[model samples]
Target: MPAALHPDFLRLPVAHRAWHDRAAGRPENSRAAIRAAVAAGYAIEIDLQPSAENRPMVFHDYDLKRLTGRPGKINAFTADELAATRLIDAEDGIPSFAEVLEIVAGRVPLLVEIKDQDGAMGPDTRGFEAEVAAALGTYAGPLAVMSFNPHAVAAFHAARPDIAVGLTTSSYRPTDWVFLPAAACDALREIADYDRVGASFISHEHDDLARPRVAELKAAGAGILCWTIRSTEAEAAARMVAHNVTFEGYRALIPG
Candidate 1:
């Protein structure tokens, strides 16, 4: 049997992007948002991607237009340049992964999502995973890493076997990845390579939890988690199947 996942990770309500509320000046992955989650005693989830300087920055989009209102890719700017570009509707700018970790400071557990760089996913591809590992080298707290790409999970697991890792799954549609061939999209959607990736947990799409594979994984004791829960009904339904949730949009109705 695989190793049992830490119970603390399965019990806490994970704040997706740190309780971000743009109107409140707390943007997703911003310092203020992370602090809010910490105060609420909820675990925090953040996204990591490298800037031009190879420093891991805490952000979500590949392009800067959506959040930063800048006309360029996130990697086009150095860490300092990214930090100086203000996030819309908030005073905070893009934060370095190290800075976000410091702000959390073990106040709550963390779930780090490694964003995919275009279509690159293999271990021999970009070194974003290594950069993330290095940034997190000294973080002495409850934390786990996850990604939509199985290769990303595998790369991290190979480097830091001690740190728990997970795979994010969704029922893929052709529109989801127009560049990929149908077979490739099918493989990703089915999570067919999960066993080979050595992931300790599964952060699946809430709607996709009814799949037989998800139930089997849960019964076999792989930690069952789900993401992007935004409403009370969705949270309630997801909790019925998944052990814990990654939530955002309105306050989460935590499972009893």
Candidate 2:
């Protein structure tokens, strides 16, 4: 069997984008939302992408219009520009990845998802994957980096093997990998090839846990986590297959 999974990582309920509750005035990935998660005692999960400056910024979506009402790509702005942009419904502005680490202050573990638009290997891409790893260098907290792109994961591992890393995957459909080459799409659909990237864990889509490779990994003791668990029914389903869950919308069902 593989080594034991990190106890704190498995035992905690991770807040998807920091317990975002827009109706309550906190927007997803906002500093206010993150603070709410810290106060509520849930672990945090956030996305990181590079600004035009190549500094890691705490935000999701390749485009900024959804969350910020901004009209350009997120990477079009520099870190200072992004920091000045406020979330649509909240006063808090976009924050740097370093700022988030400081805000969490090791109060709880963090799962940092590195959004990789460029599928380049190694640190040459100047994408958020490398920047995220670089930013994490001085952080003295429990954290893990994950990505949908295997090349990004492998490249980050090559740069910083000390940090925990994982792969985020789902059973792929045509619409999902439309941007990728056919061969790449075929490989991603297999999902178990995550080992190519040295992923110690797999944060799989909750509904796709029944894939044979996933079951095989779980049986061999690889840490298996699931994402965006929103309701009691989904949580119950995920609990049966995943060691931990990244959840939102309501309080997660804690494990014994």
Q: Which stretches of candidate 2 lie over 4 Å from their true place?
A: 1-5, 119-124
Stretches > 4 Å off in candidate 1: 1-4, 118-124, 253-256
lDDT of 1 by residue, 107-129 (tens): 78899999876463434438778
The local distance difference test score of each candidate is 0.83, 0.81
Task: Write candidate 2's Cα lDDT for 131-234 as tens digits.
Answer: 77778767877888888877777877777777778888877665766766766666776775566777789888888888888888888767899987989889
TM-score of each: 0.94, 0.92
lDDT of 1: 0.83
In model 1, the number of clashes is 0
TM match of model 1 to true structure: 0.94
